[model samples]
Structures are given as structure tokens and as C-alpha cells.
Target: MIRTTATLLLLALPLAFTRPAAAQETPIAYTVAFPNAVHHEARIQVTFAQLPAGPLQVRMSRSSPGRYALHEFAKNVYDVQATDSKGNALSVNKPDPYGWDVTGHDGTVVFTYTLFGDRTDGTYAGIDKRHAHLNMPATLAFARGLEQRPAEVKFELPAGWQVASQLRPDATKGTWYAPNMQYLMDSPTSLGPQQTRSWQEQDRTIEMQVLHDGTEAELDSYVGLTKKVVKEAAAVFGELPEYDFGRYTFIANYLPQTSGDGMEHRNSTSLTSSRPLRGPAALDNLGTVSHEFFHSWNVERIRPQDLEPFDFERANMSSNLWFAEGFTQYYGELLLRRAGVYTDAEYCTEALSGIVDAMLTMPGPKRYSPVYMSQQAPFVDAAAAIDPNNRSNTYLSYYYIGAGNALALDLQLRQNYKTDLDTYMRAVWQQHGKTQRNYAPAQPYTLRDLQRVLGEVAKDTAFAGQFFRQHIMGHELHKYDALLAPAGLLVRPARPGQSTLAARLQYNPDSTATLGTTLLGSPLYVAGLDREDVLLKVEGQKPISAKEMQKRLAAHKPGDVVPIEYRTRNGVRTAQVTLQQDNTLEVVPMPNATRKQLAFRKAWLAGKAK
Candidate 1:
């Protein structure tokens, strides 16, 4: 028999338990329990022991997986102290980086931490009038070795303070349970005060509990449309999974929410949306729900090879985050259309916007491939402008670019099989979803695996096979136009590159005869050089890629005369076009689509058909 990799081994404990202890001291484990309703405040108690000797270390996560931003949970530890049976103090200090070490003895160490009702932005207890959210990363505390050992969590509610989380309640231990620390730390609770609601669909029970000060105003919207959200999400991805089927949560934090985004999870997700759940706001909520809900079928269950047995200490690299994150993003919006929550036009508009966003803006769009980015994530750092939590913003948002590539690839797959993305994705789920828990390996699937199945919807489905190599897995952008042809869509070409006088044109695709150059928008652009002028050399040096081009340009500014060689019809012409900076780049998207585009758009928007 093949030995199971210890890393991939899932204890297979229920994700959340509402029962008591297992009563097996030799095999100690974790159990979590709480009221099964919406909540605004929570009091959690965990039982465990501190090591007898040596340096005992423990810490809350500095950052949660999936949400790449750094949210140091240690800062939220209020009134934190460790003690023994006699309530004696233990010498503890912030040792090294993200952990606290117990300097003294090993006893049943109990650490009490507090979380005051202060939620603002960036996945924490941030509150404002516009929205409030129970975003915990730097807020929740945890036990060391809990991932490997079984631990339990119990919560105490104030008055009628209802409960809301993906965890279950244990009548026995009077606590909630997780198989190990991984699930406990990975999941959190958002409760206190909120309007409560629930509905049942098939075998699964869905609750649309609401949170926020303006609870009454938006309560009806969720209550009225709870079933719709459930049905729509379930339609595309089949029934909700084991833990949560049709279970969609609508949490409102009365704080002024940041302009963009939410985080999706296995059973529940957190949203920092500015709008209410009615009218246009209601529609937005539906879309958010649809996206996160579909995650149950993709990331939550049918996951990739690298993400399983997650490595919380550092970046867990995987070549398939494109599938885990990118494809899930695709299905999130697409599920909305299948569920009738969004129109095809709306879906197309959202999908196209992302594709367009990736075409430009990102400076390193051509520098690193998706697989390289995913694999190198552990060793890379995000630039200041790229990722907010990044010590140095060097990399870009993997979700946006990676998924955009997936989008282009999906389109290619559809065209190859003369089918759509839905067909290929659903099949992958059917086969892999069965034992998804064992996923997260090095070779979850290969180029051929996707290709063989893609041909199911069409006979000559060789396009995606070529696409993965020539574009997605490589440097070139996948053939978007060719892929969209069968589906009757277009990738709307991006505006041409522009340069300044001092900045020599590094590379300009020789598509158009007219040297496509824009006025020097920056100090480099101010130089009289136009874009695509076919630079033969720079400062008497050979011109290469953009990085080298930028490096050469940064060395000189306006009024600084520099030697430049241009490949004009007049042969290599060297001239100094007075250097001036013009920092302007035009980026725009067109709302153009053919009848077929409109037809499929309608089909996707009308929600999934029954």
C-alpha cells in the first residue's frame, strides 16, 4: 500500500462541531460550538496546556491565506497574559518575529485575549457608518501545535447576542469543534447583535442573517431574496457541499467600507461592500454571494494540488492558483448569470473589464508568466504600488492577472471544443470533487488532462493545449481573439505604447507602418522620440526589453542630450527631439458586442435555467 503523504493527510474531522468533547484524553482534539445565528460579538474559550519546559511559543496569524495582505493579529491581543493552575504569571516575550515564547515552566497555560468592537478596514474589526465587518486575521488568537493536535473552542454570547460563523455547536462539550488547529485558525466567527433569518432548500439549510446598524432598512431585501441566491449558486455548481449547501451569509459592518472586494471561504465569507442589500446594492450583494458561493464547488472542495495541506508559515506556491483563484473568480461571476442574478451583458462587462485591466496598467505583464508567479510567490515580494501589505510592492495581484489568463484560456478551451467554459469546468469537478480533500499536490492535473476533457464539447479541441504552452504557461498573451471567435466575442485591442524623448523606445511591435509614438508623457517621454520608432540603439547602446529601456532612460532627463538611433524608412536616424515629460496613458474599454455576444450574455444573465 502507498503511504499517504503526512502533509496532505486530512484528519477528516467535521469542519465545525456543535457537540461536546469526544472524551478520549489519549487522543486529544478540537471541538467548536456556538449558537447557529447571526452575531455581532463573541467570546471564545480554548482549553490546552503550555509545554512543561523549553520555550513554548504561540501566535495568531500575521496574515490569513488567500487575502495576501499582512494583518498582524498580535496587535489585537488586548489584556493578554499567560497563567498556570494557581493563576501565576509566566515570563513571555515577543521572540524573534511572529511568536511569543513562554520563558518558564510547562503547565496548563491559559492566555486571555480581548477584541474590542473596533473594525475599520483591511480585514479587521474596522467600523464606519457605511459598513462594518468581522474581518479577523490580526484580531483572533490561536494555540501552537493546534494544527497538528486536536483542540476545541467554546463561545459565550451576551444577552440575545445571536451567533454567526461556519462552525457548528457541540451540545456535549458545550463548545464548537474542528478536526485540528488548521480549521480552527482558518475559520472565525462574526457575532454580537444582528437581525436573524433562515431558510431551507432541499437537504441544506441557508441562513441570510444580517448585521449592521441599518439592519431594518436592508432586512427585507435579504429575507425576500435569500432563496434566490441559494438556488442560483446551487444551480451552476450543483447542490451546496457537505458543510454548507445554499448557506449564504449577508454581514453588514456599519463602517464606511473600502471601495472594492470581499473574501470567499468554504462555508462563509466576509464582505466589505459599501452598498446595502436592496435595489442596486441588493444586486451587488447577489453577485458577491454568487461568486463566493461558487467557491464551495471550486476552491473549497475541488481545489488544486498545491493549496491543500496549506503552509501557514510562508507563501505556499502552486502553479494552479490560476485554477484555484482565477478559475473560481470566473465561475463566481458566471454562476451569477446561470442563476439569473446578472444579465449576460452585465457578466460580459465584468469579465471584459478584468481582461482589459490585465492588458495594460500592470508594468510586469510581460515579465513573469502565471506559473512562474505562482511558484515564485514564496520568494517574491509585492511592490509598494502592487500590494499594500507588501514590504516592497514588486509583484501584482495574482487574482486579477492570473484569472485574466485563465479567462483567455477558458475562452480558448471553449473555442477548441466548440463548447463553453461551463462544460469543461463541471466535468473536472465531477471527477476530482469526489476526493478533493486529497488534492493540493504538485501535479494535480497536467496540460493533457485539461486537453483530453476539453475535446468533449468539440471535436478539434486542440486550441487550449496550444494555448497553455504558447501563452498562459509562457510569456505571450494567449490568443484571445482566436479563442473568442467561435463564441462571437473580441478582446478589444489595447491602446499602443507611448514614449518620451529621453526614453528610447525599448520595443514596439512592428504591426503598423506609422511609428506608433505618443508625446513624451514623462521626463523620459519628453524626449523627441516617439513610441515604436524602431530603436536600433540607446545612448550608443543596443535597446532590449522595457526594463533595460527604463534603466537607460532613468539615467537621463529633459534638456539632457542623448544619442538615439531610430530605424526609420530613412535608415538608422540619430536625432535629439528635445526631451520633455508627459505622464499620460489613455486606458478605456468599449461596450461593443455582437448579437451572439448579446445572446450568450442574455443566457448567462438570466441566471442558470432550472
Candidate 2:
């Protein structure tokens, strides 16, 4: 049986009972009220009934789903209290920072707390007079042992407000349903006076609910653009996943108070941005829309085994995010081009070239493979730390590394294997992602599974093995120039003759330059200069700004060793640093191309919305 919300509720009822079976069948219910919303607070109550004859451990999740970092969500909860079925106060023990242990409950426990939230984004909860945006883990507390119990939530919304969420709507007004803890935690809710637009595609409802400070007409135009993006993304996968609720939703919050972020969930996506629905900002916002919707097929369902049962207690790391997130990152922009939202030049210069440049120029990918980089997501993926990190030298985002791999593999597949990435993705979908078992993938994939699928798609195990070893596991980049030639694209240096120190500098008011992390093998690093070192002079001349520094470097040619003076924590230092030619690369169309090249380029970039 497919665990739809209704079916799961029915199945869950039989497991709980102490009073009459009818009364005992009551699911775990929560009631949320926002009387103190002006103060960015919400009063939340959760009732666990038909207990198993022991103390119930009620706790707040330390981590949210899709977010790899531990957010310590319990810190925001205060004024915690618990009561029994007769409303008598129970003993609540603060055994740890994350949770409370409640004893002396009369077969039922009602746990309540005041949650304070102010940030509006995908990972945390935001509450105000304007709206209450709730990412479940950041808002709700759950009983430890009752993970399998069905759950229902009721929102006591203020007047003139409505609720929008992926949770199943119940017959009772203001209530929504989830099958189990996994589904409940994955569901994010927005309660506000928001504008909504919905359409049907292949008999499945696709809805866009936006909480924005814009007119209805502007939203209508944005929705039109969004529809095109939706069409292009669906074309890549051939069809949308069969949504668990027979619907898919895009819950967007674009307001002055919102922070920019995109989070993917089963059957929906949370898109929050401070940009409005107008002009270039609108297009930029749609970029996130394209990315997050594509994730509906990739990360949300095309699951990685390491993240299969997402642990809410600690950080979740994976070795397959390159394919999961990186491939999606590649398609996010490609689909925009396919939808005609971006011209060929715009895509090549802005999106495609950026990926190539980071992979080729950045030292991180040269040192760490995509698999190793993917494992670092817990620390780098929005993780907070007071200590400085050497990420510039040791790390490149898996998003970029994976996208680079996707680009190389796509070009190689087209040239040698007589196929494309779309075909391989569909094959992976058929093998690993298409089957749904409750709230997650029935068959989540591993690194080995991905390699196997690639072998199947290419019809050659040897090529797949070599590609995975060189790119995915081993730190080796592809010959991009050769791979892009068939499509009449050239990977060439952006500034070939320009000389550089290759270190980012923050010009100070005191006529000194503070160096950021100097890249490995750069002139600054070779001269024993690192981050926070103040550059007193270069070539015996003080350069006050970045432009001035560039002008000074322009006077000399590459390989010219010039005297430099800098100050470090110990004392002043003097060294001779050799200037290096700029190695930044870009992807551009060849001026003169054969008809075959044009055709190949068109075949690759043209819309495939049928």
C-alpha cells in the first residue's frame, strides 16, 4: 500500500489505545497559536496520547532536513511546560540541551512551549505580524519514541490569513495531516495573506503561493515566466514525479524581511528571496525556481543512501551530492537557457563559464575530489564557526565540482557514447528514483549505484569506471577544450596577458592592503604572505585600491620578480614576488564555425518541451 496521508492515518489508528478504541485512535495532534506574533513568537502545543506506559521524551530537533548543519533549534524554545490528560502539571527534566524528559503523565502528555523566531528562510522559522513562516523542525517538538505515529496539526491563524503547506488538508478547517515523523518534519508551512496561482499539468495540480509585497498583475507575469521554467524542467525528466498528495507546490516568500534560500521537499519547494517580481530581479528569482523544482526529481526522490533516513540529532553527510546537487546545479541554468529565459551568450558567459573557471582555476578541486568535497558539506554548507577556515585552499563547493563533472560527462557522453545527460538521468530515475515508499525513495542510490547506472546508460563499463575513478573519486579534471569543440564552444583565458598577485585584497584607509586568503602558488603565497597580512608596498610603490594594484601590476610582464613589503603578526617582511599571467577561463562561441557545430549547439541548448 502506498502510504498516502489518508491511508497512513487509518493504518496508524489501530496502534494506539487505552480508553475506547475510538478515543485511543487519536493521532498525535498539535495546536499552534500566534497571539504574540508581533513579538515574533508562537505558542505551540503538542499532545501525545495513548502512551506506552513510560515517561515520554519530548524534544526539539537539533537539525532540519535538507540542511546538513546542526542549527541547535532548541535554543529558541522557552517557557516550556507539560501537563497530563487532566491538566495537572507534570515533572519536566532538562536532561540535555535538545530535549526534555517528562514523567508522571497519566497515559497522555501535552507539551507546550513558546518559539521565538525572526529570520524568514527555508531552514528556520520566522514569525511576525505579517506572516508566520514555519520550517517544521525549527517550530515543532516531537516525542522521541512515537516517530511512527501519525500526526495532525492545527493552526489558529489570525484574521484575514490563510495557510499554505505541502501537508495534506484535513476535513476540519485549519488542520493538516502527515503520515509520520519524517513527513511531518519535512513539511514547511506559511500562514499569511499571500497571493496564490495554481495550474494543472498532466492531471496533477501545480500551485504557486507567494507572500510578496507586489501587485497581482506583477505576480501574474512572474507566474507566466515560472510556468515556462516548470515546462522546461519537466521536459528534462520527461514528467514530474507522481506527487504524494496528487499536487506539487512552490511556497515563495519574497519580501524585505526574507533571506535568500531554496529548499527542496517531496512534492514541493521552499523559495525565499528578498527580490521582488520585476525585471532582472524577477529573472534572478526564477533561477532559484528552476533549481529548486529540478530538485523535486533529483535530491528529493533520486535519493542518496547516506541521507536516506535523515538524522535530526546530528549533521548528515553524503558522498553523492555532486550528482545529486551538482548535476541539479548544472541543469538549473541550462533549463533557463532552454526555456529562452537566458540567451546562449548569457548562459555561456555567466553560468557555464563560471563553472569551468572555478574547476580549472580553483586549487580546491585539484586537491580534493568531488566525493571528498561532498563529505565536507556539514562544515561548509551554511555551518557557523568563530574560527577562520582555509577553505579557499582546501575547498570548492560540491555544487561547482559536481556541475563541472556533469558538464564534462555530458559532453563526453554526447561525443563518444552517442547519448546525453538527460538520457542518463532518466535511466537513473527509472532504476533508483521512480519508486516511492512512503516519504522517501524505496531504493536510495549510493556511489556504486550511480556508477552502475552510468555504465548501463553508456553501454560500456570501462568508460564508466574510468570516468568515476578520475573525476568522482580521484581529483582529475576533463579535457574541457576538446569536449566543448563539437558544440563550437571555446574554453579560453578571459585575460591572457594581464599580470596578477592572484590574491584578493581589501584596501585599507591607512594606505595598506589587507590580503584575504592567498591562493596556493600565487605571488603572495610564494612570498610567505597569508590572510590578514598588510601589504605596505608592491614593487616599492604603495597601491591604495585594487584598481591601483592592478595598474601597478600592468606595468610589469608575467614572470617579472618584483620587491614587495608586508607586515605580519611578528614583524615587517620583505620578499621578491614573481608576477603570474591571469589564468581565468571563459566559455564562448567560436566566431567561425561549421554548420555541424551550430546544429550540435542547437541540439544541446534548444527547448525540448514536448
Candidate 3:
């Protein structure tokens, strides 16, 4: 059997490439066809010159970058077979967790599997080749003995289907080749009919690819947001140099079942949503689009070292996701403002809306310790906890809490200098945002790097640079209402009067369980209880009255231990947890803050030029 030398991309930092780039030349072809819907299940065949040459071994990737999870795409591979050049049977064996060996074969190894392309979210294989989402979550099977880069994949088209992923150059007759491993890995391809549209603005040309089920006319109106996005993100980078820069937006529509989220790729992004692109859908479309668009700068080009040349086997975690996601969170909203697409009232209302959610979530300082949040993300992601007592321990999403941090910091900076966040905002991109390709080659930014950069801008502001440690790094939230009140702004919380329990208490997510655990220091938490712990009965009374429950719990002083039964992952456990007061952030209407604080709040928000 013959195997080819591997090739790579210049500046492609992470991949391990083989020497000489390209050597042997046999045809390698793979065809992923969707016979029914968007789900994919297909077979792959590799043809070389020999009978069991003892030269090839294959393995699948553990996961992909950007998306933070371990999704073993190769789990679906089945019914593998090998044959000699003359079509004789050869022996094959499973060598490791994700590795397979074809020993008694000299020519070809054919792998067939029924890929479950059930959902449109994440990655999936689907029907008609015309309606499939490309490469995401699909197996990145590697020839173990060969370097990770410089490999090839040939496509066996069904005559009517067109190749969709980024793989190029079809070999002599039957094989569709990837040429290099970098191309095989990063360049995503699709196999089906793609709906597309193009429009030009100034020096940039904007094009969008819509992966559809043939009914796509409804999206024609949604293309308008792309121009707005291009303009806004370009402004953040200072300019959208047409000749030097360009971006391609991909809209992957699973029509009836849309994921409603946009994930950014290097040059394109993948999105799934059921909302109509024009009317009410436009609002959500703008948001998801804006977020992913911002990633073009924050993640795609200007990113953390771990992100670039990323490890596909597992997640690349960084505390800086707060910077990557939060700043983009801040900007996703700012883009609307910068484009004049959102009125001041709209922008302010949007900003106000988030504070309410964050407050209810009450994510505190401990959420993301300075040590590592991203590294522990898979285990601690929001999905894992059905109910949490102190969401702070859960490390509220950077999208929400972190965004709040950005707003809060911006307000503090503006209040200090009577200026706005944009002043220091531009500093992030210029001093730290997008400078080069890979972060490892250059100096990586630390939390201190961020502190120094923002500190220099806040030199004269009312806030001290050390405040970043207090609020940003420390997760301390101040009563921002006082700061905003002076500017005729007031955000009052809906009242939660202490009343009797009218209903059995249970977590919103896990109604089946009772007496859920509240975080330490949480009013309910400090009162003694942990998450997943059921309050079988309040004070031993089943269906206890709200009044009685409140009276009993409220009457207890901090450090009072209360009996409780909880079913932990291990088994049923009972304990008396001490009640304690929590240090949750509060946002009472601060109509009484000093004039300077109010000015800072308004200016910082207003100054954000998107």
C-alpha cells in the first residue's frame, strides 16, 4: 500500500506535518451522501498499491475547537472491510480507542457507517446532499502513522451532488483530494446544492451561502443585516479594507428545525434558526449574526494562542473567553448602535434587560476563579446543573455576567473621566485585540495585560485601575443604579415580598426534585441547603404554608443548621446545612448617586461607537 507525504499551510501553527509534503500518489476518495434528510451516513474507500503493506492506521478526532465539548465523531464508524488490489478479502483490527488497523490488506480499505444526522445543530449528515450541513462534528479520522497534516480525501459524487466542503482538487478520475492535512482538517466542504447571493459595498464584497432544503426565497430579505454587520465590525477594527480583507457569511438553515445560534468559522459562520429573516426574526437574526460577526475579529483573526492552531481533541480553555465572548457581547449590542440600527432607547433598554437576567442569576466572584474557568467548562457548563444555589459557583456565562462586567467597567471608566467605554474600548483591539495569526508565536495577554491596558485609559477616571481587580477580576458588582440615577435613569427590581409558600417549592428545571440546594451565602442558600438537596418538608411539615416556611427559615440566624435530605450522584445523603447570608450582587435603583457617577454611566454607554 502506498501513502502520500503530508503538506501544510504556512503560518498554520498547530498542525503536525509530514516531511516532503506530497510523495506517494494513489487515489483516496470519500463520499458523504444524504439519502433522506440533513443527517449523513456514508462509506469511505482508500485505494493504494499493495496487499497488506503494513503502512496505514486510522484514528478519529475527539472534538473540534471553538465548540467546547468532547464529541467523538468516529463513534458511528462500522462495517469496516479491507481488500487486496485484486479484490481479495484482507484482515482488519481495532488497535485503540479511536484507532483501526488494516493488516491483511494490500490495496483498499472501505469503511461504511450509518451516521446519525438527526439534528441540525452541532454537526450532522443529511439527505439529498442538497440539504446537508458540512463537516462539523464529522469524523476527522487521522492516519496515525502519518503526520496530522498533508493527507487526502477523494469524493465519489452521486452524479447530481456537488461537493460542498472546502476540500479542493479532484484526483485524476475517481478521487476528490484534500492535498494536505491542513486542507483536510480546516477547510470545511459541503456535498449538495447551495443557495447563494452576493452584494457589494464600498471596497468590500459580501456574499452569503444558504444551505437549504430548496425552499429559500424567504431569506432574501435577511441579507440586509450582513451589510450592517460588515460595516459595524469593520469600524471596530478601524477600517474594512476591501482589497486586503473580506468575509463570507454562511447561513446553514435546517428550516423547520433551526438552532437559532450562529457559530463563527475562519471565513464563514454556521447558523440555524426557524425565525423568518425579515420581520420579528430580524431582531434575533441581528443578534446572532452580530455576535458571530464580532467573532470574526475577536476569535477568527485576533484570538488567544490556545484558540489558534487549536487542539481538536479537546477544548482549549482560557479565562480570557470573558474577553473574547464578553467584549463581543458588549459589541454585539454596540454594533446595532454604531450602525444607527438601534435607537438610544432601544440600546439602553437592551442593556437594561440583561442586567435583570444577570441579577436573577446572581453570578458572583467565585464563578470563574483566576486559575481556570474554560479548562473546567465542559464539566461545569451551565447545562450540567439543573439547579444551582449560588450561580456564582457555576460561573455565570460570560455572555451575560461578563457582558455586565464590560458595561460596569465602561461606566466606571467614563464616570472617572466624564468620557466613555469606547475610549478604552478601542484600546482592547489596538493594544490587544487583533494583531496577528497565532498567539503562541507572539506574547500571550494575561489578566495583568488587560488590567494595564484599561488602567492607562482610566488614569483620571473616578475609578482606580485596581478597581478592575475588584470588579472584573474579583467579580464585585456595585449598586449601578446610583450611578445611573443621576442621568434620569432608574432600574428598579420587581418586588419579592416575603410571603407564605402558596405552592410546593422545587427548582424550575427539575420540578421532580424538591428542596433544591441554594448556594452558600444565598438568602435561601445561607439559610442551610445545597443544590439537589430536597426540602422533603419544611420544619417537618409536608406542603408547609409559605408563611410557616418563611417564618421558620427567616427566624433562624446565620450559621443555623437545618435538617435536609438530598440525593447526590453517589446516593441518598442527609445533612443539616448551616444557613448563611450570601454576597449576591444587587441593583437597587440608585437615584441618589453623585452626579459624576451618573455622567460616567451615560457617557460610557453613549460613547460606545459600536
Q: Which candidate tops lDDT?
A: 2
Give the per-residue lDDT of model 1 (tens digit) for 1-610.
0000000111123334312343343222222223322232223333456344566666766655454334455665545566665678877787756666665655566555544435543245543222234444444555554444545555554455555665556678666555445554444455556666776666776665555545565666656554675676666555566663235454433334333345555566554455665567666655555556566566556656456555445445567655556566665665555555555456556555555445443444556666655564444322113432321112444455566665665555443444656666777666556443411222345445655655554455565466567655675755555555444555552322323442323364542123343422333344544445576665777666667666665665645666766676656677765444333222222256567765653443456646
For 1-610, candidate 3 gives per-residue lDDT tens digits of 0000000111135423434434454434445444434335555554434224564676666555455555566676666666666677766678766657766654555544445454444343333344545454454455643432344555545655554443434447444444444335544455445567778755555666665544355557566656676776776567542221253545556365544545565455566666656555566666767776666556555555555455555544666666666666777777766666666557666655565446344544445532244345454432234443443446565555556666666655555565455566566566654454321223345666677766577764235455656655565555666555555456653323322222235533332346443543454454444555555443444434444455676666656666655555666656655554322223343546577655544443343334
**Local distance difference test values of all predictions, in order:** 0.51, 0.85, 0.52
**Tens-place lDDT digits, model 2, residues 1-610:** 0000000000111123212332236689999999899999999999999887878998899877777878999999999999999999999999999999999999999999999999988888999999988999999999876776678999998998888899999975558988788888888888899799999987889999999998899999999888888898888878888998999888889989998888888877788889899988888888888888888888888888888677788888889878778888888889889999888888898688999899989999999999999899889777889998899999988888988999999988988888999999998888888987656677888999999989999999999999999999999977889988999999999998998889898999988999898999988898899999999998788868888888888888899998989999999999889899999999999999789999989988899997
- Best prediction by TM-score: 2
In model 2, state the lDDT of residue 604.
Answer: 89
Model 3's number of clashes is 51
Q: What is the TM-score of each candidate against the true structure?
A: 0.69, 0.95, 0.73
User: Which candidate do you rate higher for lDDT, 1 or 2?
Assistant: 2
Give the Å error, residue 183, model 3: 5.6
In candidate 1, what residue range of length 10 has the lowest lDDT sum?
1-10
Assess candidate 1 and give its lDDT.
0.51
Better of 2 and 3 by TM-score: 2
